[model samples]
Target: MVKTGISYSSLGSPDGTLPAPQEVARHAEQSGLDSLWASDHLATGAPFLESTVALAAAAGSTTRLEVGFGVLQLALRRLSWAAKQIGSLHALAPGRLHLGVGLGGVPADEWQAAGVPVAERARRTDAALRALPSLLTGRTTELPDLPGASVTLAPAVPVPPVWIGGGSPAALRRAATLGDGWLPAAITPEGVAEGLATLAELSGAAGRPVPRVTVTVFAALDGHLGGLSQDALVDVLHGQFGFPRELADAVAVSGPPELIAERIAAYAAAGAEHVVVCPIGGAWELQIELLGKARGLIA
Candidate 1:
């Protein structure tokens, strides 16, 4: 059955201490969330963190509950290398990995620093997506020069579900044509409805199944999860994302319980197959409880 889940970017809440990734993973799984998703931001963690490693730990922590990269920038990584890494994870996690991809269009200086070119990112990403399933499935593909320099991936484990992310027209088309699902973030009711129409056309053109739709939405419930107020939550939204306060507030989702429920229903009505709520200001457990209750779905 379709399910509800949360996508946590890190182990800890904004304020203080956190359990190890494994512990957090167990708690989330035990809470009844069907899956766990981690953002693939290498630098976002203040101390030391990497997405895949934490997810590996999460995998070790639980026996069930699907785990995914909330988003990993395929555009920046080498296709062959990424295939090997993700393929190994798939072997370990078995049927639980969801490969979420995005361009992110990160700053050039950053990409250059990492030995990748910003201009070539999109093209490379497209190539990677096409090549990943093939390479990961144990067939050797040529990787330029150095003839016979083929690398077979770890194993042909359960094929990781690929979900594309981003909001551009091209991204929507990519999701419908090449992805198992679409993973969009910070989207609105109107935006989702419009995008789904595009997806339908793209799916028909590509002769693929009607693509599934998942979302990474910014959400907050009544009262303080940690110590931040609803208004403070709005500020965090605007500050972190550089979104305008007015528009951010429009999507912040606060106040009356009835409104929150209606908004969630509106999201489902707008074509979301699975919506991953991101509680902006709250204790992790509290966020889990409030959102799960509000959405009438278990964690």
Candidate 2:
């Protein structure tokens, strides 16, 4: 069965205000949502919270709902610092934390702010992924190509399952080799099927088990999409993610509960093990409640 999750940030909300993380967490757990997610952004000129801090808040507030970084920009931070933050958050939620890492492509200013060379993000991200598991597990590990000093985290925590996010070939290959799952955003069911096929071939060549698959989509409940026209809804998605108008319209889910449920079922049939839904333009809580109802119709 496919699991259903919700993104906790205000990234896709029509309004800039986001609910308190604690409230969102409690509500999600009570509503039976499987997981809650937040994204990482540095200097995006948007009203976004720091991903790790936000996730920790959510994890601390809910005992059963899994809290995750929808896609944390791991390449932008020093590995040691990133590992420490993740380890600390894991300590709060234990087996309930999911670390979804990605190569963030946005607001060039963010890369500059982090002092990470924009061109080297892929290499840097690969290096971090190679070493993160051991570091988070509190094992002594050598830092790659930096000045000497093997390190180990104090108060060891279990390594959270890492889901790699991106749609590029390199990203898919990395997911096959290094991730516990692949979480791609704004992709169609056909795209997902194709990507998973690539992942399977890559995993086979590497002698690694096939990774789990998850897809993230923007959706809104209600028959009329929170009073926005279909054109306006597409515009919001384009403005936020710069997706082509046609692609944005094609990938976003909107309409009555039955239609939304059918869309999710399509993704499940295409082999997505989890579908993370980001409510686009509506009362966030109401949308979540409706989304849960839609999820129930899938199986």
Cα RMSDs of all predictions? 2.9, 1.7
Distance (Å) between predicted and true CA of 67, model 2? Answer: 1.1
Clashing pairs in 2: none
Please provide TM-scores, in order, for all candidate models, with all chains considered together. Answer: 0.87, 0.94
- The C-alpha local distance difference test score for the whole of candidate 1 amounts to 0.72
Best candidate, TM-score:
2
Query: Which regions in candidate 1 have their CA more than 4 angstroms from the true location?
Result: 15-19, 45-48, 144-149, 222-229, 255-262, 295-299
Q: Residue by residue across 1-299, what tens digits does model 1's lDDT show? A: 33566776643655556547787678778767767787765343354356688788888879997788888787666667777778877888888888999887476555876677777777777777877777888887764322456676656655688899988888898898779988888788778888888888889888998677787767666554344566776788898788788777766676443555566677778887776766665567766656556555312
On lDDT, the candidate that comes out on top is: 2
> Which consecutive 10 residues in model 1 have the weakest lDDT in total?
41-50
Candidate 1, 4: how far from true, in Å?
Answer: 1.6
